[model samples]
Target chain A: MATALTRLPDERLAELLHGYRASSAGPRRRALLLALTIAFLVAVAAQVAEVDLPRLWEHAGAFFGYFDRITMLESGAGRVWADPAEWFWGWRKWGVLLLDTLLIAYVGTALGGLGGFLLAFCASANLVSNPWARGAARRFLEFCRTVPDIVFALIFVIAFGLGPVPGVLAIAIHSMGALGKLFSEVVENIDMKPVEGANAAGASWPAMVRFAVLPQVLANFISYALLRFEINVRQASVLGFVGAGGIGQDLIEAIRKFYYNDVAALLLLIIVTVMLIDLGTERLRHRLIGALESRA
Target chain B: MNRAVTLRDAAVAEMAGIAARHPQQFRAMPPARLRALALFLASTGLLVFGLWRLEFSPSRLVDGFGQLVHFLGLMIPPDPGTWSRTMLILRGLSETLAIALLGTLGAALLAFPLGFLAAWNTSVNRLVQFLSRRVLDSVRGIDALIWALIWVSVVGLGPFAGVLAILTSDIGTFGKLYSEAIEAADRKAVEGVTASGGGKLHGIRFGVLPAVLPVMAGHVLYMFESNTRSSTIIGIVGAGGIGLMLSEMIRTLEWGVVSFIVLLILVTVAVIDTISGRLRAALAGARAG
Candidate 1:
């Protein structure tokens, strides 16, 4: 570049030096074109989703207005803050329902976690040499997870009658499928050396898993199970919309009946509960992971 | 004694001598076994309490099994009623897809900037970052179904409400996820940009954003895949999608139609999952390249 520049005039050298910014224009134009394409796609999606600007604008007040109404208590009361007791008048009933939701999440997670642990071994390619059995197990887990838990709740509600039973069963089935896939993946990633040794020793299948697979995957499995429990608590709350169980039934009723204050109260309770569970489970999972790593 | 047997005997004897010297090594359970046992007992108690309070019994289980079989019998054909009904269900499926697409796209767009605000290293100020993080947490803490219900009450129902509901819920998730990804990015490139006399925004755009865009895009694609599932169910809350149709069919006791819709949903979601999986793989490949 020094030799080439020495051959050039000062005018040309200055021009070339100043021309660096112009080189960037190519990428700038390309970025603009890309942005335009994305904008076009976004517009198309908005149209397909039936986004109405005028309607949205017209209902803007109503949308925000609902929040105001929910925060409000009866006449003469400024808001939910005006009287906490009045806002949570049905706390006792809601509390019982909340407990029911927690129980459903607990039992359902336990049942599903056990089912997943058993099935994961069969589904893992490293563990099960039978292709057909592995494929069937994979497909079964997929089917369990693919269907929304609420749909399962609806079907179970019809089959088992309206109560927390269907809710628990729905959560169990969905969690089983979800956790089975995860557990199998964990099994697939384990150190195969221990498994090879166990096999060479003529250990039975169950014995091999207990000594080789379980020890390696137990920490990950427990962490995932605890995470699923946190999710299931939130899920159990929603199962009630189908009359399966949980506080969701009352929450739905409040929405339908336009009991704005009740809706706000119930939503607040649910949000707080979910956040608390998320925090608690997250700490436990980290601790479990730490213990596993230290042992290794 | 045979050579192999004598060798094995000597090894066993040595191991026994070692065990005698350090007995703890042969203990069956780990040091934390007591804690584990207590945890097991507590969980078992909770499970028993759950079953008792929820009124579960062996008789109920047996009856439920028979009733479930009867329901399966009703769904053997998996019919979708008439041709017109099939078309309606197909259209509902499309609406659900549209809602998921628009919602996820909107969320990705909104979260792109919010990511910078929420990320610790790139945030404008610590207080703003903290506040934004809390806002995103609370927003994400409320489930998408609840958002759909709330939006339904506001918008009076339809796909738009579903779109808004998904958009709102996903924004919080994407924001938190995007910030975490950003925070994990190497800061050397960003420092190089700033060292070259670039402003903070310039540094972020040229260094941080380019580095994390793939991870962020991958996350957005996964969110789209999951949102499709959420949109399918949000309709049950009257947010306007196949869920509303599903709930309606269930209400009218058209078990065949319900089964048919469920199958359609399963197939559609599987297809979406495959497509998004491919896109994410390609994105990763591009990043590697």
Candidate 2:
């Protein structure tokens, strides 16, 4: 078999199959064109919307105006930051605000993660088995996520009288919806053999879930929780707009006051924080999953 | 029967005894870990700062409720007065629809190829896939509102800014969705393409794209429907559309006008949702059939 006609001459093979296989280039080109058309439509729409890029360039100063009010970098008439000593202190203040934002995310994520884990079981179609239970849980999750975070923040702010309570509550609620759905999805796709075996052994529901279900998707749950944590941090940054508390308030103040430099600085801080969280989460996920797999 | 029950119980006890001989899970959590001091100082510190900064109090909330109810009262008997104003409302809502369409289409275009490159199984290298996926993540990590604010600042406020924001934000999302679809494509067809002396791109173009395009198109359509609601809000930031009118109405305490715009937005969203739902179902059916 290895030497069967030496697999024929390369030229012979090319000739044998020639014209039989259609060239994919036509479809490839068509796909590319489709993409280009999509882009073109978007550009035309952007034009119709009349964004006025040139005007944006002209009144760039207003951006600065909005910035200063949010950051409180300027006191009295005209811009300050002349005193180097005050400048250093302002940097410290910025750090504190950043930490405050992190704290809001931490609390929100931990509480939400815990709630999501339990709700997830009820939501999973495979686990629930009961059609009505699954439908009710799924609908509950939809209702939870449909209301935007800002809308939730506004409602919470009204209820709690502003501050971190509202921000935390809003993030927690949103997280429950988002995390619950993802968790249930993971649950649905997990191996059911162990669960079935446990059920056959006369184990109660709780015991079955504990012994059979969780071990399969625990890593996934952790991975999702970490991902949500990173998201919560970003969300925390914007909670201050509604006076829910966090560095977002400072950022908004800077924007409203037209402090462009401060805005730039705060943006830098946010970008760095996000990158760090992302990296840390990735590493933690790898470590946790690695250990889980090795143990199994 | 009584003897049979006794034998069953005796057998269970023997099985438990045998299982005890093969013990598992030896580790135990440390008691000191429970007693360890949990950090609350930072949380409290931030909470205090928040309280001070927002000037938030329970009494203020009570007071605000009255004002909220008063505003609600003012919104009663929404009068859709004058043909010109009615036309204006319709026009603003249409602009929003246009924004959603453009944004979804634009994102789909930019996302598909990049998504192909980002797919773990289809990609030429792990590095390219990883980098592209992260780029998509960052794009999706931030909310549409932030994008509107940034673009509004960059482009200087208008419907254009709103349009740009939705497109930019949706691109990242589309990339993530498209990549997942590509990853899930049947490997057999891809392998068949490869066996015919086709390169990676050839296989993807013929074998993968056809399989996933419908799903991707359905996703794009759904996004368009969702973005319509978002486009309304972006307009508040001077991006353009009904949001501008709504915000203006709110500011001027024209509750009637606000209610009219809100009703318009709800109706528009509901209609788009129905249409998109039908489109998605059709696409799925076509794929299955």
Q: Highest lDDT, which number? A: 1
How do the candidates score on chain B by TM-score?
A: 0.93, 0.79
DockQ of each: 0.71, 0.23
lDDT of 2 by residue, A1-296 (tens): 46443478888889767744456667678779977986787666656666455775676665555555434444543443454343344688889888878878877776677778888999998878898888888877765655556555655565466678778768878888889999999999989999999999999999999999987987798789889988888888877876778888877776667565566567657767887898899899999889778888
Candidate 1 docking: what grade? medium
Per-model TM-score versus the true fold: 0.92, 0.64
Off by over 4 Å in 1: A1-44, B7-19, B26-30
Lowest lDDT block of 10, candidate 1 chain B: B25-34
lDDT of 1 by residue, A1-296 (tens): 45432488889988997797689888799779968986887787777678987887888898889988899886657889779999999999999999899899999999999999999999999999999999999999999999999999888888789999999999999999999999999999999999999999999999999998898998899999999999999999888888998999999999889998999999999989988999999999999989888887
- Chain B of candidate 2 achieves a TM-score of 0.79
Cα RMSDs, all models: 3.4, 8.1
